[model samples]
Target: MVSKRLFQSVAEQIAELIDEGAYPPGTRLPGERELAEKLGVSRVTIREAEIALQAVGRLEIKTGSGVYVSERKPASLGALPQASAFEVTEARLMIEAESAALAAHNITDEAIDELETLVNQMSSDDEGVANAADERFHLTIAQASNNAAMVHTIQSLWQMREQIPEVKATYEAVCVHDAKSRTDEHRAIFDALRARDPGAARQAMREHFQRLLESMLEATERKALEEVQLRASQSRERFLAAAKFG
Candidate 1:
């Protein structure tokens, strides 16, 4: 008999297979018999796992074709490094909240001075330098955590930092308020850190990230939907024009 954890583990593995374009969105998975044979699980366990995944909006049951992966990628997309946009934002929010807590408890005058220096050098005037300094400011707080592991998260953070420019630009193209929104939130984070109130710092960071995360997710999905609709409209127009000419 497969343990519950083992069954869940296999289920997550199958989810990852779908997320990495192995199955691709809207593609039906193999039949229960094939999946059971391939993964060495009973059909009963597979059915249970499928129900769990389907409940999470990861899989869509196609009546006769098997399980089709939905557009939303699930946690099975690997360690989040290879995750979808939604997963990446969620992971960042989680890590950043903890980093803010550490900053609140452990930040010192020295760290603040370092932060101010970094902030002073920050130049939205120069987009490239501004982006790097923004990253440096966040990493500084993580370092103030006095946790080597947190500081060593630089490798993953680097990817996040690099993505910030494009993400920021995308938002910029959409609205005028994002820059002020970012600055205001960062200022709150710094203030909370200076107060040495861990709860306040964490909450401030959490709320800040929550707003941005929601904005990013909503905007991305809406934009994709809009693009699809726009293309559909154009296609219809072309079909009408061709009918008139022919």
Candidate 2:
């Protein structure tokens, strides 16, 4: 089946070539423009596809050199920068709100329909499917903005969201408890985009992140408290044991 995302499709093609030994491990691939021409895709798509491949350890990108196929796949999270969930949420609140507003002005009927389908997927009982849909829904909005920079920035933010262990854990904790709210917020954002109301779209996106940020804060505090309590209990147990020996 064809992949919905262009970059993903390109990445798959590149992986297939590597697997077929057309481009063996440690072999540097063609430059972006050359690869774009070969694949019939844009340079931006080629870049995005390479980044995706690198994230999965299928490829390695070197500055001042070129992209190379990796001999082994590494743990994805270990390669990402350490970012807290709060930091990522705050960044998304600012950037994605603008992205949503811009998308509202430029989004087509096709993108709107795609978002609606994604929202439905977000309602699925399978957590993995719903989470994947949520990611695509946001990316589709980013693409609809008709801004390459915005799409790249949002894609980076999403990489942090999915690949950073702490960020991923916090989101999972918050989302597991309030899946309905999460789905509803996405639907609100989609509705605003479909209506072509930039202000409403911005507000919806901002509100989504605002709630997420607040939830993360609450979860963090609760976690800290639980850790403190756990340590105190352990200390108390040690004290009682010593006292009994005395």
Candidate 3:
């Protein structure tokens, strides 16, 4: 199905192309003038898309040269800054998979202790504190991967979550179920990490983040859309009042 979202459509199209191997990792994309011509969008739109893609670690734009696809596909894609809920999922799928794998090899006693502390911190009597600590726990996991870039990219998701109020609310609500699933997932991931099994660690990370991704995507974005209507009404009122005053 064609995406009704214009910019998102543009981003997804590129993301899919990379996934399908049509764009191929480490290959350079056409220049802005050429891409805009091909994409049938203004160069400005192309520029915006590139930045958005870059934020999520998808495409690397070299001003002196051209835009080139990064060596890592899924991780690179994850590193790109998230522009939407789907993008966040895309990034999580890409980065966290590798994150889990690396954590399996990198886990130290200190890291394990930190994880336990985070589990305790997750119970934030206050939601704001909870979210903050929750993000910190995830960030610590990503950092444990020993990949600086991955850590930075995953951290970016914290800001993206702010824009996604629905995701925050829904996930927070889900955390109420004895918080068993969450603790279990963290324990499973720790088990893998302690064993130094890369594949299992990655798998655990995937399952946990995938649940979150699914829940967020299921949340209808009607609230944000409704705000558009409110803005329109305020704009019209201001215009009419201006005409009457004049």
Candidate 4:
């Protein structure tokens, strides 16, 4: 089975092929089903790869028309800066902490009820629904702050988080691991807002992000260890193959 990382690898491979003129500019690439079969990956993986390539300006999707190779390419494959999950959490700490404080002062009962709904949704076992609910919860807090600028800024940050494939992938993994804790953190913030305690709200928001920071660091360390193990395994396989040949 193709792993999540393979989606990115497939995107890179498709980009390289485009650069080599396998699919020239304006030419429609194979359909998602065809690409999935050709690449030995699921169609969902193909879709994700196409989205990543499209984000980096390597491909263009047309409404009703097929996906086409872009005439222009990014300066390099590294054109998009990879934002670590830790960095995103840091930014959220700065922005969301204040937003929570303001929300404590300005939030309405209706908004509080909506937040409760979101929190419930986030606690569900369905990862997709939980992820969406989590995003909505944060955005709702920003909205409840009654500051349009804060809302816009928070929305922009979320958009930037999604645009970077690495960040998205890292957070997806983190969400799976930290979903229950994250939902509890959201409830803490909501409780503070319900009490109209600005200080408590801000502190809860900061604590939530602090936990996220630690989790992201742990995730990064785990990824590094996995990579090292994979390299060692490959090296051992090569050694065994060479010995057998000898």
TM-score, every prediction: 0.58, 0.72, 0.50, 0.66
Q: Write the per-residue lDDT of candidate 3 for residues 71-147, one digit (tens) a residue.
A: 75434322334266666666777887898788778766776776666666566565444444455456667767888
**Model 1: which residue pairs collide?**
16-76
Off by over 4 Å in 4: 1-82
lDDT of 4 by residue, 31-132 (tens): 989988988887756766776566556776543366899776543433444666677778889999999999999888877887888788888886655765
The Cα error of candidate 2 at residue 30, in Å, is: 22
lDDT scores of the candidates, listed in order:
0.66, 0.84, 0.67, 0.80
Candidate 4 has an lDDT of 0.80
lDDT of 4 at 237: 99
Please estimate how well model 3 matches the true structure, expressed as its whole-model Cα lDDT. Answer: 0.67
Model 3 clashing residue pairs (backbone): 55-80, 55-81, 56-79, 56-80, 56-81, 57-79, 57-80
User: Scored by Cα lDDT, where does model 1 land?
Assistant: 0.66
State which candidate has the highest TM-score: 2
Over the stretch 109-129, how does candidate 1's per-residue lDDT look in tens digits?
Answer: 878876766565453665444
- Count of clashing pairs, candidate 4: 0
- List candidate 2 stretches off by more than 4 Å: 1-14, 18-79
